[model samples]
Target: MGKPKGRKVARHGGNPNAWREPKASSPSLSSVTTAEGLLEKLQSYMESCEFVVAEKFANRALERFPANSRVLEAAAECFTETGNITKARTCYLKAISVSPLKGWRKYLGLAQLLEGQNAVLQYTRGIEVMERELAEVAGPAQVETPNVPSASSSTEKDTAEIPTARDISNAYLSISELYTTDLCDDDNAEEMCKYALDKAMMADPKNPEAFQQMANFFLIKGDKEAAAQYVKGGLTLWYTDHLPPEQRISPENQQKVGVDYEEGSGMPGLALQIDTAKALIECAEYDLANRLFTEFITHSPTDPELWYLNGFSYFLHGNDYYPQARSALTKAKKFATTPHGICYDIIAQCDEHLESIAKVLPPTEDSDNEEEVVQTEDSVNRPEQSNCEDSDWETDEEGCEDVEM
Candidate 1:
């Protein structure tokens, strides 16, 4: 009777052990103890474009790890995305102050927020830091791996934060851009830009950005042929077979085309492709540009800029492609007006192109009327001439009389 009074267990219809209370999972964001954990969570939010959530998480991380350079940098990225430039600048400055020589990215981040000489200065400093850091780990044989530290004793310093080759190359590319733009009037602008580009190529010979930058430099110098060559070089890095006929790599040569790029480096592939296509258009490679722009349109159907570019490419091609150009520009105009609601200059340009096309390609009815009018005018104003047969007969009779005499 006492045994019967023991607690009873409920069972499902099939297996009694089939389901049990789910075990507590790993800690959530609220329970994240380490700065690294918080930074990871923050990055996840940022990647998802959840800027508000990222900003809040970043603020929390800053409070938890006030002196952590990475945490500060992460917070700064959050602020920058959320349009809080003041706080972003402050965080970047603090991060630099905390560990001035350790992170080159912080300097670049701050540089992006500034302009003109100030931006140039920051970019230069960032490049210097990157060079120094890279030199430390230049040779694998010279470097020694440290023992893995226990979790409790590990710090951010124990983490490997080495900059990749592409990072250094892109840094130089940024300096090259600054020299071409904000510092264009400086005495050594062209020379500095060339130097930076050379360093970029040396740092990463396979970098598309370096090639594209060189192309841009040549284009600015009005050397279109050189620009086109560099554009081909850049495009070859990613789209070897998709390039124009003159630039496509043969099967045998494809093996020689070695790209030294990480999985995700510099700009997105689509953007780089777009840039190369633009360069192609600039270099009068209209057919190839149109092909790339068409593919891009399929991927980004509603992108007004892409449509405009496709239209521009067709428009520049020749009179035969006017119709296709008209269709693309019309779509671009519609997208720009309804959704984008800006790019008035682009809209104007589209209108101008449409007008030019209309002038060149008149309506069928009007052209038919013009043709009829021309035919009628030609028939009404037909020219008259003397009969050569009568002149020949008179001349022949005179010659016969002279012979008889």
Candidate 2:
């Protein structure tokens, strides 16, 4: 029988170079010819669903064009699919070494590889690097598209049904719980805090507590600008609804201070000052917090909680105000560990607060540990904190006081 018309026997398997774009379309294509033959063989095997043979073909391509970005990418992918993570990582590194011109694609692939291996820190670190590198390489002017409103920004749009409000609420709540519970996991704690902030924001947009929680999250992450935004949002909510703006200023200084003030006892004004001072401190607005702290001490210098807060704020400055921190913490010790007869709960809070601050401080020459564990400078969309576990929710009196405002 005669062979089918237009059919030709394949010679030396199909050419992998067939997948390479033309030089006119991609300048990178010119150097890609070295692996064309092996690429063709791999392509043919892949088409036939012969993964083992395809991987073998890819290995051969790597031998011929070890520094070819496309070949290395293909080899990495092949090894990854076959559960050879070590080899896959090596191939990916080779691809990155070959051509650093793939923009975000190379970093994105590396992120995937790191993620697959369950290296959460490494994966997040890769993303951070990619973001910075891509930003640096991007043109001065951004290519703007027509304004398409995001769902989060569209106020008039109906709230999409979450279908799992309780789950989401629990998720955020659980992350908040970690800040109060765990001590050693600053990295996970910060990530969890962000997860909580996002989940809580989705759960209740109108809740000032959610915004306040996010402010603390940013503070812990050392993002002053982001923390300030959330703190401002929370403060706006406080002034607008809960504690009328007038109550924010002291009545005694209303005329002299040239600001609106509550026409009553200074307790409310004192509380507002304390709360605002704490928020400012958390946002790294040390100058503002210091000014407020000076005024607060003039009014109630002996108050244990106020002393604790002032000392805590000072400690947060680290090396910036060592002498002041030493004095403040000494005063705080009088309220915390000394036999001043302070409330047990207040004393406990002081101890916990001091411990947390001490752990983060730079160690002295005689300290046992040289290295300190700190939160990472990376973002992560962590899994839901609660995952719909109903039994996790419990009433806590400590955080309840803040809710009243």
lDDT of each: 0.73, 0.52
303: Cα error in model 2, Å: 2.5
Query: What's the C-alpha lDDT at position 183 in model 1?
Result: 88
Looking at model 1, residue 179 earns an lDDT score of 90
Off by over 4 Å in 2: 1-171, 175-195, 239-279, 291-301, 311-405
lDDT of 2: 0.52
Stretches of model 1 off by over 4 angstroms after superposition: 1-33, 48-60, 140-154, 242-267, 301-304, 330-347, 364-405
The clash tally of candidate 1 reads 0
Q: Estimate each model's TM-score.
A: 0.66, 0.29
> Which one wins on lDDT?
1
Tens digit per residue, CA lDDT, model 1, 1-405 = 011122335653554334444237422446676887888888988998988767777887888788888889889989999999999999999988877767788999999999877887887888877776677778746644444322222365556377888888888888888898888999999999999999999989989889988998998898989999998877776665454455555764455332223456443466677887898888887887787778778767977688888988899898999888877877765554431123345556777887898899764664345435534543443323323343321222122111100
* Deviation of model 2 at 297, angstroms: 5.4
- What is the C-alpha lDDT profile of model 2 across 55-102, one tens digit per residue? 766776776666666667777777777788888888777765554433
